[model samples]
Target: MLPKEAYDAGHYVGVVAHSTANNGDSADGERNYESTTWQNAFVHFFVDDQKIEQVANTDYICYGAGHTANHLGYVQVELCQTTDAAKFTKAYAMYTWLLAKLLFNRKLSVVDGVTLMSHAQVSAKWKESDHTDPIEYLASHGKTWANLVADVSANYKEMEGTDLKLQTLILYSGDADLQVAADLAQHFCCPIVQVAFATSDLLLSATTKYQVGGASAPAGVTLLSGADRYATMHAVLTLLGK
Candidate 1:
């Protein structure tokens, strides 16, 4: 088994994309190889034309990148090498989407050299590793680093748009309001904060904001108030479509 380690910061700051460098390989094949040589090197995920497989837990660090990046907290994903144009095209889509999804999940914006990086970029920036991978491999299939960045950024934006619509923050003032807000928050998988305890950063992060009961929310926030508790719950459920 690959040794388990946490990132220096306790959470990943970005994602590093790499290619296996061995052509005509699938995620399963690459994973099997890594399974044996995990002490030398291993990544959190592997992607191929047909699937994306998690060879290790992303919550912890992997040995994919170099010492600097692995310690600096980057979630690394490897794309299995493929010679076929069709296979490359399919794997590329999944690879970019996975990168975007990882960044999006962390609430990190896709900044090429920072939030989203190629192995080549990692090597050039840190100098901890001399390997420049996925660059020449991408060129072999008519794809460039710029292409990957743009594609991942596009996917990130798409996810942001879709998720923002569902993202919500619920604020409650009183005990009764708290009970209702907690239920709604759990149902929607959102956060519930007391009106007095709400932070500006937390409030601003959510696109859809709600205030339960007669609690006053910030200027642009939506207030869910009704004659009684059940009525307020109804309004909240109706507005949030829960």
Candidate 2:
């Protein structure tokens, strides 16, 4: 689930990766990362080869950023190590895609590092850890923070064009067609938000429908749904182009 106040207030997200794993979202790595309950170290999102797992609640604080305010203020995302060339490309692409979706949903800039930062950079600036996991990793791959930011712009711009500014709300369930909503968010690339409670009727610029039986849509919501999660995900990926 997305954060309550964080999404409401548009909190920045910090992206970090472990350098030692040398592979994508290893099961052993998830256990090690999640099991370290002793320290104030935890992340909200975990990125790997083909999946982006939400480990912690985003509304709360993650203690992974290495600084007090950084930890408390930003959403933290941890990536499995990316040393292998093929693994890194896949992971990096997924990271950017997930990030563009998240940032666009949060009303943050997809291409802006002020909102998205590397763990190494944030730690170094704030005097946190040794401060060199992803930096070293990026250096080895001939990519830099600059390259990453550029990629965000390219990826997001290519995927989405128009900017939506409505207070976005996403009502997703494992059973319901969740990817449908996530796809709309990916392309419209606006700051529409999700809410725990909503009014009896929602007013939007487009036409949308609800899957439930009792609820009602006032007007201006449209219908355009997908078949499955995979197709739905890709559909949203091309939302901006539409």
Candidate 3:
């Protein structure tokens, strides 16, 4: 079951794998009694190689976690298996596919060094009770949960920077009626007026103006602000093809 917030926020995806045995059969078995029993049943969505099963409503709270049962913004995806290498391959594939779908549908980019924690992250009780599932399974595959999260966060940051650049260009072109010149001046730590005038000879004069011990004029340009404002503006316009 995909959480509404996962769909709404368009970013986060949660994956869970069971550590304990599902029913009487081994982790590789297709059917388990634990999956059938109402009292012992836990988790919302269960994934097997052959099919996906939904046990609880994504919108409602499920009794998957012993302590933290009511996490407001989490999607619980459970793998129907125990800690077995054979079952882990299928589980890995399922989790990877789910993650891909979540990222694609939500337009999320993963960041490097971000932490993808587990149920243990939220609940101390679960952690203290020796309850470990996906974390162990993931470690066996030589992938830490933190690394997975970092991958997502790194991509997310890259995409965000790209979006900001596009927005800056649109504003600078005056298409959005934004004060991009002022914004650029503030970002570059220079005077707006000086930045405006230096736009004409930015490539050539900027280096000299910003050079150490250079005669700094308004906006750090070498040229004086008086009388030369018009000439500077004209040069800038010509260079910009305005």
Q: In candidate 3, residue 55 scores what lDDT?
A: 58
List, residue by residue over 1-242, the lDDT tens digit for candidate 2.
32233432355553444343354455346746576661546666777766677776766666666655344467766666755788778777877776666666666665344666677666666776765656666677788777777776676665554443244444433444444665556544532323223344443422343321113322443323346556544444454354
The local distance difference test score of model 1 is: 0.88
Q: Model 2: runs farther than 4 Å from truth?
A: 1-28, 111-113, 162-242
Residue pair clashes in candidate 1: none
> Model 3: per-residue lDDT, tens digit, 76-107?
55655535665666655655455434444445
Which digits, one per residue and each the tens of the lDDT, describe model 1 over residues 1-242?
A: 67779899999999999999999999999989898999989999999999999988888899887998988899999999988999899999999999999999999999989989899999999888888988999999998999999999999999987775547788886788888889878877898888888878777678888888874567767889788888888988887687
Q: By lDDT, who's the top model here?
A: 1
Best-to-worst ranking by lDDT: 1, 2, 3
Rank candidates by TM-score, best first. Answer: 1, 2, 3
By TM-score, the best candidate is 1
Candidate 3, residue 49: lDDT: 52
lDDT of 1 at 88: 92
> How far off is residue 49 in model 1, in Å?
0.3
Model 1: runs farther than 4 Å from truth? Answer: 166-242
**Whose TM-score is higher: candidate 1's or candidate 2's?**
1
Off by over 4 Å in 3: 1-35, 67-73, 82-87, 99-116, 125-129, 150-242
